[model samples]
Target: MTAPVSDHYSAPRRSALAATVVALVASVTGCAGTRAPGDEPAPTGQALVIGASLELTGQGSALGTQQEHALRILAAKLDVDGVPVGRTRRPVRLELRDNQSDPTLAARQAGELAGDEGIQALVGGTLPETALALEGVARKRKIPFLSLAPGAAVTGSPDDEGYVFKLTPDDADVARRLAEAVAAQKLRRVAVLAAQGSHGDAGAEALPTALKAAGVRLDRTGRLPATGSDFRAAVRRVATGRPDAVLVWATAPDSGAAAKELRRSGYRGAILFDSGAVAEQTLRGTEASAVEGAYAVHPMSLNGSTLTSIAGSALARRDFMYRYLQEYGEYHGFAPYAADALELVAAAARLADSLDRGRIRAFLETQVVEGMAGWYAFSPSRHGGMEADSLAVFVVSQGAWTRIS
Candidate 1:
């Protein structure tokens, strides 16, 4: 299957990089500044740099591309002067490095960002493994790291996760929701197909726990390469099980392949996918009937509801979505999450009234803000920053994703 022409996210433009960096400084008013312990003072005459390591040209590019794009968009719409710290605005600069889908490189770049670039905060990591790699750097450097991926590995231990935070729903939470959804429909047997990685492993581990009380049994389990091109063999094996439903936990194009293959096998009672498959564009050219009744567990809804319950109000969400469409030609599943992560950081900086990393980290632990996705609040015990209500079920009806619950 060919990628849609409009799906390609262009590289960052050099000419506007400085201007965009300057725009990222959000304004803060009426805040007193006190330097918090373990906090580093802001650099003089230089922008407050924030570094990001994203998979720019590899298997995870589908998701990372959107993350990078979202950062660029948010940088433009934030503020012109920079974030207000100590009654003065500090110019914010974004320095992005392409990890090319390698976790090692992601970690290496993160160290460089912290040691050499002097970035106060960091964002990126669409893949769970990459996030795990990035997490180490955050802990070692004590820089606030906002991960865009969903996995317990990103925010596992409070001691290890002090500097780490994520905006997306944890895979454990998503797996539970999916299991409950299956159990509600009286489906006792399920075929689980997960990709081979941290995301897949987390889902594989969480599903059974959620289904144990419901008495849903896994009839068969299969694992495929996270970025594998062919899934016919896995689909055939799953179809042979004749389970009540098939749960595919994988990233976009792979999830798309699973749906197509299952339909071709002609044994679908119900086809369900994980959060990564929620992006509507993943199944763009497929026949409506191919996945007509398919379901997905998504972190947030992008449809009809006013979204007033989320941060920034419905108007802000509307404006951001509109701008996203205008800029990218279509909305990617993770774009809003990435944008919201940046917004949350900026909001934290405003609350702290300083560019001090420790201050911002402390502020985030108790700060409650409505973001593009939904309500977000963090605590010492929870670094994932999401709750059970963070996920909702959606179904494919009439060739579109419709929120059913």
Candidate 2:
């Protein structure tokens, strides 16, 4: 079932909080160092470094690049006053590496990062394969790893995922939302064109059950090529039945490519996408028109609305969006999972009063923070921190992703 939106604060309360947020944003942007009298003295300890192995120049670059931007912005912001760890406030640093979208390379990089004593926590992996690779390394090294990938298997078994946490919503939650959207539109039958990978595997596995519960029939399913070479044949196979709608469960580039191929193949039915399609590449150039009216199940952050209030999550999101716009000129509605990962790490460090890998991991399991993207409630049994209610429906309108629900 779709979750209801949370209640908004009253107008007076919102205005008061908004004023406080304005000051917070000013301090963040200005990097103000002045402290009030009687404030604790700043520490001169070494920076607390976080490591990241990302697909910066490969198939996952569409999402990885955005994450890289988020990490840089947040790292800089935190360094202004640093994060509190006990009585000391230490600066933040990021040691980033490019994994080239290869799972093998990602594993090697994760090993190298985890071996470094200065690197306390790790975050990366925009692709499921890369995330799984990193998870293996985190488990072996006993270091905390925050994964940005949507693959449910990243946290499949909590016993083995004690040191790992996922910042994205679970595949099952996304699938349920998509299925409900289809039912609401009265789309009786739907075909799924899933990409070939662990991400696709999870979606395909959970979708049938969700669609069934929503009272919608699953007409057919086809797999897009792993290399994303040619989607024409796959699109043809899935569009053959002329189902009421076609759901493309794939990441960017593939997501937009499949939409273009579907339109070219003369399939004019409604197009639906998984959260991975929220990347900038999905709506760029000709592909924008191809997916103009396509709907997607994504985090509520995709709305990217102007700041009207200053609730914790809303304020953080607004500040993040403002910083992102200053750095990149445009916000593509992608969730800042990397930013939240960094914040989560810092919060854990503060809670544990130490930077020890095991201590950070232990405290991480107890956090419940309102982050930039959404609310994350992490615990010993639940490593997939993003709340299900954070998922919402979005549609491509005028070459932009606009939240619909």
Candidate 3:
């Protein structure tokens, strides 16, 4: 069963909580709400339950764990009493289920959460396939789904994406940033190793176009199951190509394993990874030297200057980082995305001044809010919420992620 839990900010920080709540509510309602017809009234006098299905114990666990932590933090921070909706204090409950990194399980649990649990909105596993699965449930159930993963196909067109939205930037942008890195490094030829799934397929499909734009040649390409751990053969195949750089588009430990293997295979070329591959937990099994000098293209949250610019002030950014570290003990790459997803939902609820799914969805379609990761704006035709400018490239140096332009 998905755990149904509620949390609120520390009692000692009432003033801060009020301020944050005001900001969240105002950010959405300042120019929100053009409701559609045939909307139903929301339930009253009960906890507004939102559901999340996360890959908490499998290949995606490294990032999933961070996502869960962020959910918990935002659930507490934004758990306001008496929101703008008629000055009514409503307790927001987050029900989380572990999908174990399985898309089938994610889809199944998402159905249960919507059909049986009757949650108002859905958040879920950090993969494109999972996003696709949850989107189906959202469409059928007429509830909103917020994805924390990168997948361009998740929102193929505006016509099919009324209730589905994503917090991460599109895969095309990530690939373009990666291509920029290749050009910046002056590498002409590259080998590709990507996971097998929606996220990987999207990246793999976009890479060739991006590479072509950068005048880089794709010499070799290898595909691995998202759950596949063995990369000895794939690494050898890619290494033998002797490309100027090896581009790995995968998640944590798997990509880390590929990086380690690339080094062991004596491939003395540059290594570049997709954003999802560079979290701290993902690099634990691999040696630091294997990752040293390897570059990755990820969101701007990984860089202080870019993050401060989006977050509005140095002090506000510092406060969020301090709170996150204090609560979670360690930071994970997907944490900020998860926080932004939940906070955006809460803000939509406030802006609509009701818990009705139709009203909230309507508000989200025109909402613009500054999240911990970056700015998010949604419209009838745009459901992903982020722009290409949200991405930045980073290099692993001395076992830490350092931003490079």
Which numbered prediction scores highest in lDDT against the true structure?
A: 2
What ordering of candidates by lDDT runs from best to worst? 2, 3, 1
Q: List the pairs of residues colliding in candidate 3.
A: 82-88, 82-89
- Candidate 2 stretches with Cα past 4 Å from truth are 1-40, 153-161, 305-310
State the TM-score for model 1: 0.84
lDDT (10s digit) by residue, model 1, range 1-405: 110111111244322322322222222211113345675544434456678999888878878888888887776665444555555556656799999989999999999987864567888888888887887898988889988877773343556547888888777677777887887788889988888888888778887787675679988788865476677787889789799999988887677778888888888588888888765446577634666788888755456243233222555667678888899898765677777777767767777876778888877665444456654557676666455554677788887777777
Which residue pairs come into collision in candidate 2?
Answer: none
Error of 1 at 175 (Å): 1.4
For model 3, state the Cα shift of residue 129 in Å.
2.1
TM-scores for the candidates:
0.84, 0.90, 0.85
**lDDT tens digits, residue span 1-405, model 3:** 111111222465434433443465455332223223674323335556689999889878878888888888766655533223534545667899999888889999988998854467898768777767878888888788888877773442455448888888777878888887887777899989988877678878999999999889999788875465577887898789799999899877677778888899998899988888857755565457788888887776774443323333343345557778898776655578887777677777777777888777887776655566755657777777465655677788777787766
lDDT of 1 at 1: 10
- Give lDDT per model, in order: 0.71, 0.82, 0.72
Candidate 2 residue-wise lDDT, 355-386, digit = tens: 88889888888765556776566778778847
What lDDT is reached at residue 20 by model 2? Answer: 48
| TM-score attained by model 2 | 0.90
Better of 1 and 3 by lDDT: 3
Least well predicted 10-residue stretch by lDDT in candidate 2: 24-33
Q: What is the C-alpha RMSD of each candidate to the true structure, in Å?
A: 10.0, 4.6, 9.7
Name the better of 2 and 3 by TM-score. Answer: 2
Off by over 4 Å in 3: 1-45, 80-82, 116-118, 153-161, 307-316
